[model samples]
Target: MKITGIETFCLRYRMPYALTYPRGEYQEREAVLVKVHTDDPNIYGWGEAAMWGGPFSTTTTVLEKQLQPLIVGQDPCCPEFLWEKIYQETYYHGRKGILLSCLSGIDIALWDILGKVAGQPLWRLLGGFARPIKAYASSGYYRRDYGLDALAADVGKAKSAGYRGYKMKVGNLGAAVHSRVLHETPLRVSFQEDIARVEAARQALGPNLDLMCDATTSLDAKTAMAYADEFERIGVRWFEEPTQPENISGCAELARRTRIPIAGFETETNKFNFAALMDAGAIQVVQPDVIQVGGITEARKIAAYAQMRHLTFSSKNYSTAVSLAACINLLYALPNADFFECDADPSPWREEFLKSPLFTFDDGIVQPFDRPGLGLDIDEVALSQWVVQP
Candidate 1:
């Protein structure tokens, strides 16, 4: 069916608990959701470009003012062709960042529409893989009044909730609290204190459950190497974005020096950059966000490349339910799918925005929805409360 109309919404929802990273503290999450209406009766599709800690208006503008006008009369079934069409048309404006983020949302919506037309679940439609993917509780962010003890308790609660693995945030605020001093200083934690926190989490999680750490691109190669050595001792499954995302060579250096797998490229937007990272022996485990990496179309290409290179392909999960659903569909099709990242943080946006049941963990395993398309029914009433007027 031909495309009829495209609608975009910018949403902002306050979080239950504010999280601190190297950049700063975030108390709210933002997202840009897109709805693609087609000529066929009762057949619309949904997609989202979630800005975990970034601004949403710019991407929303790109979708409404630039990309939407071009795709209204085109065929919704040809996602790849449409993706390339948008990319090439927008290349003069730049091929990455906000532009790609907007294109990604639209691409996902097209795939959702295609799946609905075919009367098949997206995972089956994509590749027909039958195995369930394992999910790791991705929580343990640095909270306002919380310390190591609080972190340990959080880890314990996640384990009790049936999560078989956990990923915690590190490199928070670096060595100092003041922004000016932080710029002059190195991005690193107080070594002994950071080790103590990991020790507490390790003690709480026990040795059986898998553990991972994300530095959020804060530490330099030297500091990351030191952290990697210590994390390997504590049995951390992988170290994520230890240095700045642009530092491909630095990430490569860190990977070469340590046995722990380097997992990153969540900030990346194209396949060419991913190829560079892969060729440099930089990341053993590649975490591509479907919403940020040009939706399932581009993510499938990256997964195939990772599989060919014998690397682990996992997703960076910390966005809207739509993003999670898209990731589950994509991950289900890949044989190298390692662990699905699910935000362990409590937020109404994550739990209450969708009418469909949020993914449930059964002994740390999560199965993709069997319904056609992305299998999500948006809560329009709740969405109205968070929508921002342009």
Candidate 2:
């Protein structure tokens, strides 16, 4: 069926308690979701553009002004053609960031449409490698009053919830400079406190489960190397984004020097950049957000590349439920799918986005969804309050 129109919604979920990473303090979660309408009244697909990189209006504006114009009459079934068409037209001005993220929403919607039309689930539609994909609980953002005791409690919760692993933050050391962007007035957690947090988590998790740390790109190569030494000593499974994503050599150095697997560049938008990171031996685990990296179409390319290189491929989780489902769908069909990020945060976004949970968890592993499309049946009521007019 031909595309008829597109609807955009900017959603903002205010957090009860604010959380801090290495770069910024976030008080709310924001996303731009798009609904693609087709010629038939019966068919439509949902998509989302994450708002962590830029303003929410920027993404929605691009959807309404730029992408919708070209996509209005095109067939949503041909996601591949539309993806390239949009990329080629916008590459001059929109190679990465908000532009590609907008494209990603539409691309995901197009795939959802294709899956519905074909009467197959997205994972099966893409490749259908295997059903169950491994998952790691992703949370532990720094917050006021959340000490090692609170950290241990969260770890225990994840373990009790049947998660195989849990990932926590690590930029508390003095002037934790994680990303290359260089934010002013960064927060600090001393080395002693940081180690205490990991040790607490390990104690709570016991010996069987996994524990990964995200440096939030807080440290440089030298600092991260020293920090990683301590992490390895604590039996930490992986060290994620220890330094700035753009520092290819620094990342390469960490991978070369450290025994812990270096995972990163979730902020990254393209596969070629991923190739550069891979080529440099920078990361042992490749992490790209499906929403940020041009949707499933581009994500698959990265996964394939990671597989070829014999590295772990895991989608950076922490977006809307639609993004979470999209990542799972893509990962289930990939050979090197290592850790699917099961957002362990207590946000109302994921479960409320859809009418019901799309996938099931078996002891922290995500079971494949066999329903048509991305298995996203949008719950408009649940989304209504978060909708932003501006």
Candidate 3:
């Protein structure tokens, strides 16, 4: 069947709690959702993408105005071709960032529609790899936001909630305090540490905690190596984003210097970008976000690629339960599935937006469902209520 129309929704929701990162704090979250309609009876598909680079680069606006128009009358099953067309056409103006994020959502939604039309799940259509990916509790705390004791308590909260693995903020705190604070949590606690604090955290946490660090594209190749030397002592499981995402060469060099595996690609737009990161020998673990990285279509492909390379593949999650449900369905389809990220912040609305929420445990595991499509029904009314009119 051919495409009929595409509609866009800008959603804004005030968070019950704030989400703080080293970069900034978010009290409210904003994103755009796409609904693609087809000529076949009552079939439709849904997708979500980032609406960033406002004014200068209207990602969703361009997608709704230009890209969506181009694909309106085209075949819904032509995701690859349509994606390539959008890429080539928008290459001069939109190769990376917001443009790609918009394309990602639409492309993902199209795949979901294709799966529904075929009477199959998105994972099955994408070559069902595995099911029930092990998940980690992504503790919602930052150095600036919570005191060391409070951060430790949050980590404890995640452990008590049945999360087996957990990740916490780093960079802003001293390595010694970061390590001491993590000791309060019971499970594997990975920190968002910079290269400067690597040695100190290693010394403090010692060998037991599954202590890892994230550089967040903040360090150069040479500087990253200094921390790389301490990996042996710290027994680091992974070193994440030591250099900018585009600096694959630097990532490669850093990986080569340390025995620890380098993890990255959360901000990646497509499988091609992931392939580039892998080719550079810059990554040992591929982290693709369900919403930001083109949904399940591209996520499964990227995971498959990581599997081919015999590398670890982990998916990132920071959205609501609806988005998490979508992620869980795809994670069920991964072969070399690693830990999944569960948004640990206390948000009742996040729960209110979903029909069947994820089953998270103190052991840090989330099981996949036998249900159809994403396994969880979307709350259309709730979606409408949160819609941001523009």
Candidate 4:
């Protein structure tokens, strides 16, 4: 069926607790949801672009004023054609950042439509290699009044929730340091302090459960290598984004020096960038966010490329329920997918924004929705409540 109309919504909500990383702090979360209506009766598709720490308004503008117009009358079934059309048309003015992010939402929605038309789940439609993919609790950001004790408690709770593994944040100045001070100085934590937090989490989790840490690209290669040795001692699974995304050489060096696998590239926007990372032998695990990397179409390409290179493919998906659903579908089809990142922290939007449960976790394993398309029924009433009017 032909595309009829496209609508975009900007949702914003105050986070239950402020979270701090190496970059800064976030007190609120945001997402941009897209709905594509088709000519066929009773057939529409939904998708979301993560705006977690970015400007939702800018992404919304790109969706409405730029990308939306390009795809309104095209065939929703041909997501690849439309994806390329949007990318090539906007190549001069927009190839990355919010532009690609906007394209991502639309592309995912189109895939959802295609799945509905085919009467199949997205994963099955793609490959259907595996189901009930393993997941890890992605938590442990520095929060107000939160210390090592609090971190230990958080890990314990995730274990009790039946997660197989948990990921914690490192490289922040620590709970004692104010975010304002961090913004000004951006000081890296001492090696000793970083080790202490990981050790506390390990102790709380015990030796069996998997443990991972994300530095948010705050540590240099030298520091990351040193920390890697300590993390290995504590049985940490992997180190994520220890150095900036631009420092491909540094990441390569870090990977070479340490036995711990280096995972990153969430900030990358295209396959060419991923190829560069692979060519450099920089990252062992490639963490591509579907929305950030240009939707399912591009993500599939990246996953295939990672597989060809014999690299592990795990995605970075700690946003809204829509993004989580998209990621699960993509990962289920990928043979080499290691883990699906789940936010251990609570989010009202993830639970309350949808009429039906998008996914369920059974002892840290999540199964794909059997229903056609993305298998999500958006709660329009709940969505209206959180809509940011322009």
Candidate 5:
């Protein structure tokens, strides 16, 4: 079949609850979705990249102006070639962040289209592996009122749901919240706290629970080492992004001094940098964001590379359900798939936009989907209702 047309939509949906990560808080979600259609009379494949805003961020503008021109007439099935072409052409103008993020959405869509064209599911197309990927409940955002009770209930809920574990956010929150989570929760709990607070949290949470500190590109090598030192006392498992993503030497140094597994590169765009991160001798866990890391196509390659090096494949998950479902599909395809970062916040807009809500989590485990090509359909009505012109 020949190339046809690519349609792009930018939608903004208000969140049902506030989404507060370490960086900031957002009440609404803005996403850029691409629909690639051909004249060959088949279902169109869809890919979405929800851009978190800032200057030079991944926005709809990046998708339309920087990326569309490069791949409009290109064959959607030739994702590998198209991915390289877009990366090379945008190297000068939009290389690292937004450019790659926009291209990631297109690249994912292209792969989806290719899979449909070949009449196979995305996992099968990418070389199928049927390992049950463990999902960790990432709830705790909504329980701000109940705090420990919320944390305790959610942990219980996740374990009851069948999840092996859950992740609780830790910051400079006082000892009250920390005590309840570390002492009360029954299931294995993981903590995604800042590097600065990891030691204190680990000491409070104790040795049994898996403690991980996400520096979120916030710490330098020295600070990372300090956190690592504290983590050693309490036995934290991984130090995520102790230094900046570009600081390969700093990461290497931290990894050398600490026994903790260095997990990072969630913001890294493609496999080239991923190769560099692997080479850095710092990262033992690869955390690639499906939306930012070239969607399923590049994610699979990155995961494969991590597995080859005996690194754990832990992906960053917390977006709309469509992106979450896409990540799960990719996770299902991998052999070394580790914990999935599950979002516990309720998103009304996200739910309405999906053709079908993904498999619900039991305790903390989500059932693998057997449907073709991510198994999600875009709700046209919801899309139209939330469509953004600017």
Candidate 6:
């Protein structure tokens, strides 16, 4: 069926407290959701695009005024073709930023439509690699007044909340780019402070559960390598974005020197950059955000490459419930299934915006949806208040 229309909602949610990563702090979280209507009014698909670390309009403008127009009359079943068309048509200005993010949202919605048409869930339609998978608690940001004791208490909650893996921020007080690019300074922890943070989490976690570190593209390979020894000592499951995405060689060097698996490039765009990371041995675990990258079409390609290269393919999700649901399906579909990054941040988008939970965690293992398409039942009324009108 042909795509008839595309609707975009630029959503903004005020956090109870500022959430800080090495990259920056979020006083409010924003995401752009897309709904693609097809010839059959009953068949529509939902998608979410990460708005970079900037204004929502940056991506929504492209989704509404630019890319949406290109695909309105096209076949929804041929998402790959439409994705490429948008990419090629906007190549000069849109190679690696919010434009690709907009394309990602459209592509995801199109795939959702296709899955509904075929009466299959995206996981089964993609590959159905695993029905149940492990998930990691992605918490422990550098919040104001969040001391070591507070950090331990927060991590303790995640461990007791039934997560088998945990990832916390590290190495932001030193060399980093967020302040320069993101327009503000964020709470940063030194390597020394980060060590204490990890130690506290490890103590709170009791050592059996896997613990990971996200440097958030803040450290150099040398610094990362130096800290990696301690990370391995503390049994860090992996090191994520050890350095900036541009430093492919640095990340490769760190990956080679450290025994801890180096995971990265969530900030990266499409398969080409990921292929370079793989070819250079820069990353042992390929972590591509479904929204930052080119949606399912590109992520599936990266997963195949990861499978062929004997690497782990994982989703680095920090977006909303729409993306979380999308990534959940993607993780189950991956040929190389690994841990799904669950945003431990409490928000209405994660629970209240959805009509029902997309998946359930049995003990600590997360399961995928058994329904058609993305298997989403969104509560639009609940979502409406967060929607920005332009």
Give the 10-residue window scoring lowest on summed lDDT in candidate 3. Answer: 183-192
- Per-residue CA lDDT of model 6 for 178-210, tens digit only, reads 446754656655668779898998898887899
Residue range 250-285, candidate 4, lDDT tens digits: 899988888888898788888888889988989989
- Which runs of model 6 end up more than 4 angstroms from their true locations? 177-186
Model 5 spans > 4 angstroms off: 16-21, 55-58, 139-156, 170-211, 233-235, 360-364
Model 5, 353-376: lDDT tens per residue? 777776655544565556677666
Q: What global local distance difference test value does model 1 have?
A: 0.83
**Local lDDT at 337 for model 6:** 77
lDDT of 3 by residue, 1-390 (tens): 999988877777776666544334456766677778899866777776765425323755777787887798899987788877887888887776777777777876787677777777666666577555555566534434344446556655655566555565433322322235443322222333343244444343334545456655545677667666766665777766667788888889888778888888777777889999998899998887777776665677788899899988877667655456567667667778777777666554456766765454435556755444555466778778877666
For model 6, how big is the CA root-mean-square deviation?
1.6
lDDT tens string, model 2, 37-133?
A: 9998888988877667577677778899998998989989999899899998888898788887888899898999999999999988888887577
Go through the candidates in order and give each one's C-alpha lDDT: 0.83, 0.85, 0.66, 0.84, 0.68, 0.85
Candidate 3 Cα lDDT to native = 0.66
Lowest lDDT block of 10, candidate 5: 170-179
lDDT of 4 at 44: 90
Per-model TM-score on C-alpha atoms: 0.95, 0.96, 0.82, 0.95, 0.81, 0.96
**Higher-lDDT candidate of 1 and 2:** 2
Overall local distance difference test of candidate 6? 0.85
Q: Measured by TM-score, how close is model 6 to the native structure?
A: 0.96
Output the better candidate (3/4) by TM-score: 4
Error of 4 at 170 (Å): 0.8
